[model samples]
Target chain A: MRNFFVLAFVALTALALPSVAMAQSAATSAASDGNTSGVITVIQVDSETNLVGFVLSTQNGELVEVSVNDSTSFGLENAAGDRWVSDFGEDPTEALLRITDQRERFAPVTVTVADGVASAVVDREQGDLERNLGFLFAIYIVTWAGFFAYIFIVSRRQSDLAREIKALTSQVG
Target chain B: MAALPKIRLIWLGFTAALMALTLWMVFLWVPTEINQGNIQRALYFHVPVAWTAMVAIVLIAVASVAYLKTRDEKWDRLAVAGAETGVIFAALMLITGMVWAKPVWGVWWTGEAKLTTTLILFFIYVAYLMFRAYFPPGEQRRRLAAIIGLIGAIDTPIIYYGAQLWERAHPSAVVGPYSNNDSSVDGPVGLTLLVATIAFSVLFVYVASERYRLRKQEDEVMALRRAISLQALRVATTSDSTESISSAPAGGA
Candidate 1:
């Protein structure tokens, strides 16, 4: 009777898993477009002029380059009361830019371009396969260490018991 | 004792039925996947075997805890049986997974989470069996085995969740919808896998139970033989002592 119940329960669970998996898959498929909407703002600081400008990149891949005096493009009128001003000068050899999202979260990305290259190359330092391999190696070491430790403890216990058994036999004799 | 025979028969029947169903579902009912072709069929056995191996580790953990609490040899027996069974299934899972991977993953084996962890688990259980085989039957041996079993069982979840944790710690290769998709996410293929897992689990339980019963029986027979031999030695010692006393009397006369 117990065996029958176990079998029945297993069958029911087995029957139910497919439906659950299908529902999960359906939910995933519905949201599979993978479009994530977030604001990106870039603030470039020129050490030579001590001036800052902002660039915004949207989720739809639209890049909006805004200068300090460009108020009409931002739906604002140029007024004397405004503190914004643009300083037109020679391009600095180096620019330090901090890119922030709409929420003001900043990420540092350095862009470099070679001569006659149409595309600027961006580099972001992130975790890679070597780091993962290091983790795997750590796990392997810990697992083997624990395994050998257990073996050592077990062997010690066995020898201790054997000594105790010999002592008891000696007393009996 | 009266219920033992019935349980054995039921276990035998259950295993036979599960094996048949598994064969039918895997070979006939489950359709070959279009993307992976016939080779993907190995998932039917591989996944279930891995699942059963995990289940066996859990059982070993439970038995280990019970042995520690109760200090009973029976729990040790069960733990040994579970570990041995787990090792077998783990090996099968590794081999079958390799066979499936050769065509799909383009390598027979790689140090991936599933493969490496399963390999570690396999070695742990193999060590557990060796521990049992080397030790004589006693409370000390049982206690030692129980401790090892508990420790080995702790590695199961580490192996399982390692990949997820690894992904979170590392940069994902492909950042798209298909990146996180499990290979067994299809409808018919998922159903076939479910059936196979169930069948394999049931078979695993049946085999482990039978092996435990055999171990228990073997222990009992060994105990009985030891008792009989001790009794025979006692009888021989008494007869020798009486003969010595008689010879002393003859020497005095």
Candidate 2:
């Protein structure tokens, strides 16, 4: 029964991780692609003196303001998972509205800013996770947990054997 | 026998303290790798467990050979203990490796040579333990187990030299004689791994020795049971003969 529990634990952990692994690959690929990732916390856009408020994924979550022209473009992902740039005619008001629109307010976005002008912007639904600290912790937890659980099981077996030895020695005496 | 328990307790205490230090160094002291980032930190724990698992296999082979030569139950007991411990460590090694692989290699498992060998090693350990469990207690069981152990030792070297020979997904030896510049670790990174290895070694010894003690007790139990049963048989035979003598015609009366 104890063996069953250990095996079950191992199986569950294995089954649970594939989904996370898939997400990790996506997040890591995005991070390696060399784009800044964070949520577009706030944005103010107009034909004159366009300014967009953004927060970077770094621990500080610093808010950054980027200036863009009416001609500045936005990159958006379609249902087929292909990213396309938004250059919808003169005013980029509709594109700015698309950036601001999201199911989650802090939905991750990748942006390229050069000299305070927005070069490109892409919404990242999965977030960037290049550092991937979660996997590190998972490994540690599994490693130590396995050790501790084995130790407990071994101690219990040892106790039972000790009891048997005592009984057998008395019988022999 | 009295000293053994005290020694094991000491080793356990030492291992626990060293493990605490290892955790600190791994999580906070060492700088992150430029390439693998925080995920690379897994090496501190993963490599040490791998080393422990390999050590257990080698110990088993040596003990098995000793048992074959001297016929000492002590050696056989140690071999059994080592096999059991090796299975646990090997299982942990594989699990931790998988966890490390997902982020770094972008897959949970692959058929790389090093990994494949390690998996085989785990299975070999399991088989050894199972054989010991199911096989009847006697010289035959010990002899067969020793042979299985010696044969399994062949896989150990293959696992050690796997990366060097296959040049596959696994990075080559980083600290051994075969290590090269391409995969070498230095400074705090190397030091942390060294410390972790030592800590795990101490822990492995403690557990394996405790297991060895248990095995010794089990053997004692089996021997006592056999002796008692033999004595009872002899007594029964003697009583039966005496009764037959008493029941006879009393020397032609």
Candidate 3:
């Protein structure tokens, strides 16, 4: 039984090792460089000054203001995983401005900003990444903890009872 | 005496490995849902654990009925194991559901039909386990427990029908009137959910089997102790009578 457990642990570790290469780094990669990923808190469109911008709330609680322009690229994704986007040189009207008018507040986004000027706005379904990660980790921990604790208690009791049974049997004999 | 049967060990190892793989897929491979985002990943764990809980209660009910009909202690043992294991899974189901709800639903809990029914199931499981633990050990205890187990399973369907029966708020079932609505809920589970369900199923089976084995050994110990005590009492009684006779007046009472 001990050997079986050791072997199982080794096998599971080996199985886990291969997943590193397949890990999706979309969130991490998007967070790198000057790009910012967060929920949109407020959108400011100043037609008087011909300026369109929005305030982004990052995972760190830092609010960064981003400026959008006609030259800015747009990648819009809705709840169904359907996407609509335009290149940097293409018009942002078909994607960005229309979504700006119709979208809900605090929509998740990743804005590629150079000097606070948005070059690319990917308004996809990036969720509450940190809180969600915490939740998933918590649930997983709770599950394993509950199982292990139960197993430990059961095994210990079984061992104690086995010893008692052996001793009692000998006495009876 | 604490040694597990070969079949139980196989299930344990398989459950562990599958659970690890399921965790990887849930945390890494699956894409963040478009709407609910990463919290949607909770479905992988939540649904599977919930399903296992449901399965556990059913097993408890079935085992109880079998024990009743067969008058077999092994079936009684199985029902006990199911009750214990069911409580754990059911608690996890409610907890994971609450955690998942906080982010998406903006509340720790809701009065949605499915959620309410699942909570009821959890409570029933708890009540069944408490009854089993606190009650006296014997035919009476087993009979009453079996009755409870059989009845407790009734909540499972109530939980399943929750979405259709009254839940019209958040997420709708795939087959109900609300299924056609724009409820941006996730169900009709995808491949990851399927894998998770399979993993948790194996886990539930493994745990219950372990508990069952333990219960059997415990019964063995109890029977051994009882036999030893009875034998000792009989010997004491015989020796006492012999001493009294040896000390009594010759031919006198």
Candidate 4:
């Protein structure tokens, strides 16, 4: 009955953990979206580099050039005066608009817009199984060694019994 | 105890032949998967290894119970062999799973049901072996180990159903009935997996039987040595007594 409670507690704890993690991640993503209204200005776009340098400007005219990859989603106006969200996948050579907020630069910062918006970025990292393979392999080897070691130890213990049997046999002869 | 027939050579030949045929079917005969490409080929090995591991554990439980009932050391030896082989095949399943996970699931490890359960089961059996090692030879040791084995076998079902319990409580990403069904396992993939499973099962039986035979042979040799020593001791004592009686009469006269 005590074992039952212990198992129940463990099961309950395991069941609760992932829900907590999911809730935490959701809250975190929600909190990070508060500053989404900052105006993004395109500065320079390189066709070959697939890099779109853009400046994020607040209402106060502060500018910071952030390099966005081909996978970045940017809403832009084309030469045909049509609004479209362009990314690297759809159009490789779309024109990008340079926006200036009354800066002291004579030249307009040039940026190029790609064809389609980046759908979703999938990041692949070294996972636990691959990273811990060496450790797991070590554990596996140790476990197998323990198995054979058990056999050897058992055989050694039985050796005493073998001796006892030998003594009895010698007496019988 | 009488010696069991030497079927190891025949099993070896059969396993080799089946393995060759399985490889031929997997590589040459089976067509590549349209969706998952070449990586889906790993399913042949992964599924079979998992199945074989399950079989090995069941065998271990059976042997453990048999040993307890009969007190035959052969059953104990078979149980150990089955557990050892089960662990090996379970590891293979895990490794192959990781290999398949990289391409398919986009992650090498997940807190998924089958994988985690199998991992826990593997560790449980490892602990079982450890428990066996700590105890000395006797009825108590055998009985205790057998009881643990039975309990461990019972846990297998819980591990298997953990996913279902979790799914009931939480919203899953791949929702809907039959959303992730393997509709693509029509032709070669199915055949390859079936063949691999059969071959591995045959291999498991062959290895377990051979280990049991070796253990029985060791016991027989020990028994023979004991008998020989007893005969020698009896002859020596009888001769000593006869010499002592003859010498004592002469000394007295």
Error of 3 at B9 (Å): 3.0
Top candidate by TM-score: 3
Provide the TM-score for each candidate, comma-separated.
0.56, 0.67, 0.69, 0.54
Model with the higher DockQ, candidate 2 or 4: 2
Pairwise TM-score winner, candidates 3 and 4: 3
The DockQ value obtained for model 3 is 0.19
The DockQ of predicted model 2 stands at 0.19
Better of 1 and 2 by TM-score: 2
lDDT of 3 by residue, A1-173 (tens): 44444565456445533433333343443234465777777767566533377788887999999887776766555655455545534554455454564347456676667888887676433334555566655665566667766777877777787788789889888
Question: What is the C-alpha lDDT profile of model 4 across B1-253, one tens digit per residue?
Answer: 1232335456656975786576566545665543333445566666777888898889888988898889987777788777767776787777767656643444456566777778888898888888878987556776787887778888899877986576556532221111132646666677778897897677667655655554554555567676777777888999999999999999999
Q: Which candidate do you rate higher for DockQ, 1 or 3?
A: 3
Q: Report fnat for all candidates as fractions from 0 to 1.
A: 0.00, 0.39, 0.37, 0.01
RMSD after CA superposition, every candidate: 16.7, 11.1, 10.2, 17.3
User: For candidate 4, what is the DockQ?
Assistant: 0.03
Share of the reference A-B contacts seen in candidate 3: 0.37
Candidate closer to the true structure by TM-score (higher is better), 1 or 4: 1
Per-chain TM-score of candidate 2, chain B: 0.85
lDDT (10s digit) by residue, model 4, range A1-173: 22432453355345334433332333322211112223454556566644355455543576645555555443333334343434444554452332232122332222222332222211111111223333333332332243344434434544555466567556555
